[model samples]
Target chain A: MKKLWLLLLYGLLLTISSISLAEEESAFNWQFGVGLGVSHNRNLLPAMDSPRNGIPQLQLLFDFEYKNWFAETPSLRSGQLFGVRSGRLLDDFTLGYRLSNSERHNLALIMASYHDGFGYSVASGDGISSSKLEGLHNRESDFMPGLRYQFYTTDNQLLSLQVNKDITTHHGDMLRLFYGFRFEQHNWDLYFNSELSWYSAKLVNYYYGVTAAEVRSGRPQYQSGSGWRWHNGLVGVYPLNKHWITELGAGINWYTQAFTDSPLTRNNPEVVSFVLIRYVF
Target chain B: MFFRYRLLLLAASLFWQPAQAEALLSASPSNCVTLQQGRECHAQIQTAWTISQPLTVCLYLDEQQLQCWHNTASAQWQWHFKDMQSRQLILWQMTDSEQKLHVLATARIEVSWVQSAHKKRLWRRF
Candidate 1:
C-alpha cells in the first residue's frame, strides 16, 4: 500500500497539467467544475480526548459558477507519500435569480465528502499496520445551503450567510453557519475572501456521535443527535494565463465531542491546513 | 468434517498483487494478484485520466510483479484478481512522465477461518 501511494501522486500531477487545458471564455452564465482534493482531520476520535489527530481525506466538489470560468493558476507541490492537506474551491459556481429591481437573490447548494482514506479517527498513533492503513468507516460527507444578497455590500462584494450539515454513517454530522465577505468582480475569478463560522451541537452530533449499542447490535453506528463543531476556511482562486488554477486555502475546525465523551466518542477538536490543486472543465 | 471445515478456512484470503503491475505507470487498479496461500481472490484496476498521456499501470503483491500495463490514455488503466487465496499486502501504482504520483486509492481484505457454515455465507460476500 505504501508503494501504491507514491504512484497515485504521479496521477495527481497529470490532473494538474490537464487543468491548464481548460476551456477559456468569460461571461455571466452557468458553469460546472470538478475538483479532487485531499484533507486530514487534525482532531482524532472524540473518545480519545487527546489533541486532534489526522485523517487523510479526498473529495469531489461540483460548483455552479455564474458567468465565464477562466481563472487559472500555476502548479503547486507534488504532494508527499503521506501528505495530509485540505481546502476549498479554486473556481466555484453561483446561482442568481433576479429579485425586485436590480437586486438578485441567489441560492447555492453544496455537497462534499471527506474520503477518510485513513478509515477511522484514532489520535493514538500509527494504525495497526502500514498495510491496512485505516478503515473505510472513517470517511464522511457534508451538504450546505446558503442565501445570498449580491451587491448587498457593494457591486463587487457580497454578504453571504449559509447553513451546512455534514452526514456520515458513523463519523461526524454538524450544522454550521457562515458569515462571509466575497470578492466577485470577474466572471472567471472570485473569492469568498474570508469568513467566520459557528457550529452548534444541534448540528454536529447528527453525524459523529454514534453509540456502542449500535455497533454491538450490528445496526448502523449513526446517532442523529445534537452536537457542535467550529472551524473557518478562506477560499481563493488564481486563474493562470492558461486554463489551470491554483487554489490556496487554510482552515481550522474544532470538534467539541472532546469535552463530552462516554466510551463511545468520535474525536477531539483542533485546527488543520489545506493546500490543493484544481482543474475545471 | 473437521478437515473439510479447515479446507473452507484455507479458502479465505484477501486480495494480493505483485509489484510488476507498477509498470502500468498511470493511476489505475491491479492486473495480477498474488495469493500468499493460493486462496481464491478477486481484484481489478480502474483508471481515470484527465490527460492524453499514455499511462503505465502495475500491481505489487509482496514486491512480486503480478501485473503490468503500458496504455496511452489516462483513463485506460484497470486490473482485478479473482478467486484466489493469499495473505499479503497489495500495492497498486501508476507513474507518469513528470515522475509525480497520485494516491489513487488503497484497500485491505483479510480472509479468516470460521467454524460455522452460517457464518461462512454471511462473511464471504463483498
Candidate 2:
C-alpha cells in the first residue's frame, strides 16, 4: 500500500513536467532515468549449494533541485531516490540534502523509510512453514535514518564511509556499515562497493531457526553470527558505433561467517562473469 | 510566424517515436560483425520514407556523442567505417529531431583484410 501510493504520487508529479512542450529552464537540472539490469549471485558454500540465480534489477534515479534545476550541480551529495533487492524489495524513498561542495570532501543526510518485504514457499514434508502477508500483511517499516560521508584525493578519486542502524528487530538490534569507491576511465567506468552487515546473535537466533539436519550442513556459522561479503566488479561500456554499446564485465564475491555458539563455520567464495549488449539513446 | 512553437512540438514527437520504432527496429541479426582484425570497411543504410522534410539522421558508432550526420535527399542513407572491430557487427541507427522517425538497421560485414597475404604464390593455389 505504501509503495503503491508513492508510485502514484511520483507519477502525478512526472505528468506535470510534460505540460510544457519546452524543457524546463534552471541552473540545477531535474532529470530521471530508468535502467533495467539482470544479475545473479550464486552461493558456492558446501552447505548451501542451491543456485539462487536470476535477479531482475530495476533502477530509477532522479535529480531534484531546490535552488536551480539546470545549472551545474556537480557533486555526489545531490538528493536521490534509489531502491535495492537483496532478495527483498527495499524501496528507499529518500529526500537527501548535500552538505559539502568540495569534490574531495562531501557528506549527506539520508532520511528514508524502507519497506522490507519478502515471500517464499516451503513444503510441509520439509517441516518448513509457508505463509505470506496479504493486504497490509506481515509488514515492517524501517526508518533508515543515516548520515554518510565521502573523502577523496586531489585527483577526485572517491573514498566513502557509511554507518546505519536497522531499527527493525524482534530480539536485539542489527547494525551495518559500508565503504567503497568509484574509478573512471576513457574507455570504461569502474565502481567497487563493499558492505559489512552484522546481525546480533540474539536477532539471528530468532529469525533463521535452522534445524539440526540443516545444522549438520556446516552452514550454522552464518545462522546467528557475523560475516562480511565483498562485492568487487567492473563494468565497461565501449561504443560500438554510436547507436549501441558493447558491455563487458567481471565480478568476484566472497562471504565469511562466524556463527554464535553454532555448529557451522562456512567460508564461502563465489564468482559471476558475463557480457551483454546494450542500447543507449 | 511562430517557428519556436513548432520546433518544440517537433522535438516532443521525435523523442516519442522510439516506442513505435521498437517494433520496426527490433529485427536484426544477433551477431553481425565476425571479424577479428580489420582494415577499412564500408556499410550502407536505407530507410523508408515517412516524412516530407529532409531527415538528416546522424550516424553514431557506440553513442550519439561520437557520430556523424548523413544528408539524404531521399529517405535512404548510407555510411562506411574506416576500421572495424568485433562491435562493428552491432546495429546502427538513424535519428533526428526534426522528423518523428528512428531507423535501426544491422549489417552482416564479412571483411577480407588478408589481401597482401593472398597475393603470395606460397599461399594462393592460383
Candidate 3:
C-alpha cells in the first residue's frame, strides 16, 4: 500500500511538471516562509498533559499551485498534537487536483492524512503519555484518498465537503464538512471556520478501542463505534508589510460519545491556541 | 424628379467642407500589474492631448471628470492612478453655444494581477 501511494504521488508530480513546461500561460504560484509561534494544547488521552502550555513551535510555510493542481498545509489541525507519526515531511499536508473549477463551485480529488495513530507506550519527548495505554497494540496512521467539493456563496464565504477512505491501513473512512467566513477590518483579515468530521467504526476502533487481552483493573475492554468530532476556530491575520505577516487563532474540538465512551479515551474536549509571525518570500 | 435630386446633390457637394481635425489623446504607462488580486495598483500617469483648434476640453475617468481646459489647443497633466480594475479615460469637446459634449479621444488603463483572487482564497491559511 505504501509503495502504491508513493507511485501515485510520483505520477502526479511528473504530470504536473510536464503540464507546467508545456503551458506558459498557466502560472505557477508559490509562497515560502518560516514562522515562530507559541501554543497551548490539550491531548485527547487522560494523564497526558505534561508540558502542554507555552510550547514553542517552529514552522516552515510552503505552498504552491500550478494550474489545477495544488499542495498545501491546511490549518484545520494546527496546534493540535496527535502523538502519531505518519512519516511525512509536513503535518496536515494535502495534495489535490481540481476536477471541476468554476466561479462558484469546485470539485477536487485529494490525498491526505487525516488521523494519526497511537502506540502502547504513548510516552514521547514532547511530554504526552498515559499509563492506561501501556498494554494496547500500536495503531498505525492511514493514507486516504478522497473527493472534495467546495461551494462559494460569496467572495468571503465558503462551504466544503470531503469524504476519504483509508487505503493504506485499517480500510476505515472519514467524512468532513467545513464552513469558513472571512472579513477584513482595517488591514486585518479575520476568518471564522467551523468543521465537523465523522469517522467510521473501523477507524474509531482501531485508534481508541481496547482489546480484551490488554484489559487492566480499571481499563476494561472497550470498543468504539462510528463517531463525530466538531471544531470551530477564529483566526486573525495582519500584514506588517509586503513580506511579514502575523497570525493568531484559538479553537476547540468536541468528541462525541462514541469516542468518549472508550476506556482509552477521555471525555474532555481538546483545546488548541497559537500565535505566530512569519516572513513571506 | 431624378434631375431635381441630382441638382440638389451637386449644390450640396459644391458647398461641403471638412470638419475640424481629430484630437489625439494618449497616456504613459497605460497598464498596471499587481502581484495579487483585490490589491490596489498605483501609478503616476501622464496624459497629453493635441487638437487643431482651441476649444473647451474636459478629461473624464469613466464618468468622473478629472480635469478641464478652457479654450486650449494642447494640454498635459500628471494623474495619480489608484484602482483595482481597468478604467476608460475620455476626452470630450464642450460646445458653449449648445451646452453639449462630443467625444474627442479615448484611452484605456488596464489593471491585471499575477494571481487571481478566487484561487488565493482557496488555499488561504493563517
Candidate 4:
C-alpha cells in the first residue's frame, strides 16, 4: 500500500513536469540513462562478509528539472543500494524545490531517503550462517524531509550542508556536511569530495541497538548513542561523446566507535569502488 | 498592309523589352542545433549566390561584412560559422553610378538547442 502511494506520487510529479514542459519547453530539461558496473566493498554490518568481492551493479539514471523544481536519485553512498532492492522504484529518489538561488549560495527544500534498513532473515538468506545479527528486529528505512544549503567557494569548489528528520518511520534526524572540488584536465572531469554525517541517538539505536529480547550467546543487551561517520572519495568522468560517458570512483567510510562497537557491526572501515559506462538520452 | 503592320509591331516590342535581372542566394545546412543554449554552435556553411549582371556585391552577416566580390556574376564561399544566436546573411549590390547600396538577396541562419544553459548547478551526481 505504501508502494502504491509512492507510485502515485511519482506519477503526479511526472504529470506536472510534462505540463510545465508544454507551457515552456525551453525552461524544462530532462536526462535519462542506464549504467552497468562492478563494485567491491567492505560490509558495514555483520550480516555480509567483510571485503566482499566484485559485485555486479546496475543503475538507472534519471534527472529532471523545470524552473525551480528538480528530481533526482540520491547520492551513491547514502543508502547502500538497499532502497533499490526494497521495491522502491524511485529508490532514494529526491524531490526538491530551490528556495534561494545566487551566484555563490543556494538553498533548497528536499524530501529523500537517507538510509537503508535491515532484516535478519534477509541477511541470512544472503548466505549468512549463525551471524551475530540474528534475532534483531527489522529496521525500516526512513523518508526524510529537509533543507539543504550550498556555498561555492570558487567556480570549482563547493560546500554543502543538510539537515533532515524522519517523518515516516523512526522520527530520527541526521545532519550531513560535504565538500567537493572539481577540475578538468584533458577532457576528463575529476572530482574530490569529503563528507561527514551525524546520526541522532534514536536513529542509531533503532538500527544498531541490541534489545533484551534479541540477546543471545555472548551477546548482551546494548543501546547505542549518537555518532559520526566520515567519508572521502575521488571520482572522474570522461565524455566519450555527446551521448556516452564513463565514470570511475573510489571511497572509504570510517565509522566512529559508537557504531563499530555495536554487536550488529564490525570494526573495520568500509571501502567502495566502481567503474561505470553510461549512455545519456 | 496588315502583314507589314504586324512586322513593325513585333520589331517595336523586341526593341522596348527589358533584360531580366535575377538574383538568388542560399546557404547549405542553414540550421544548427546544440545540446545547450548559449553554447557556441559550429558549422561550415557554403554560401552561394548568382546575379544577372556583373556588379560588385558584398555579403554581410547581420551588420558585419564577411566577404565581397568585385563585379562578379556568381560566387560561392566556404564560411566558418560560430555563433550563439541566429543571424541573417544579406547580399548587397554596390552601384557606382548611384553611389548607393541595393539589397540583392538574403538568407537566414538559425541556431537552436535542446536545453537551457541557465540552470543552477546544484546536487549534481557525477
- Tell how far residue A151 is off in model 3, in angstroms: 0.9
Residue A226, candidate 3: Cα error in Å is 1.2
What are the candidates' interface root-mean-square deviations? 23.4, 19.5, 5.3, 5.5
**Per-residue lDDT over A184-273 for candidate 2, one digit per residue giving the tens place of the 0 to 100 score:** 343233445454545555444433335443333333322445434455555454435433444444556555443323332233455554
Candidate 4 residue-wise lDDT, B8-37, digit = tens:
999999888666558999998797655456
Model 1 interface root-mean-square deviation: 23.4
Q: Which ten contiguous residues of candidate 1 chain A have the minimum total lDDT? A: A72-81
- Report how far off residue B1 is in candidate 4 (Å): 51
DockQ of each: 0.01, 0.02, 0.07, 0.06
Candidate 4 residues lying further than 4 Å off, grouped into runs, are A1-6, A49-53, A79-86, A124-131, B1-126
In candidate 3, which residue ranges exceed 4 Å CA deviation?
A: A1-25, A47-52, A76-78, A81-88, A125-127, B1-37, B40-119, B122-126
**Per-residue lDDT tens digits of candidate 1, residues A1-281?**
32233234323433443553355322222222334444333334322222222332333332222221211121111111122232332211122222322443344443323222232442123333222212224423232223333234554445555554444333333333444444423212234433334444434343344445335432335544354445455555544312344454545555444323522333444433444444444
Candidate 4, DockQ score (0 to 1) = 0.06
Cα lDDT tens digits, model 3, B23-97, are: 999988887765457877667899999998999888989988889888899999998888878899999888765
Provide the overall lDDT of each model, using Cα atoms, as 2-decimal numbers. Answer: 0.35, 0.38, 0.74, 0.73
Residue pairs clashing in model 4 are none
Clash pairs for candidate 3 = none
lDDT of 1 by residue, B14-125 (tens): 3344332222233333222221223243445453333334466444444555555466433344545444343343333456542325433334333321111221010000
Taking the tens digit of each residue's C-alpha lDDT, what string does model 2 give over B1-126? 499989999999888753332312121222222111233333333323223333354434444333334554234333443334433222233455533244444333333321222121110000
C-alpha lDDT of candidate 2 relative to the true structure? 0.38
Model 3 residue B97 lDDT score: 51
Error of 1 at A170 (Å): 10
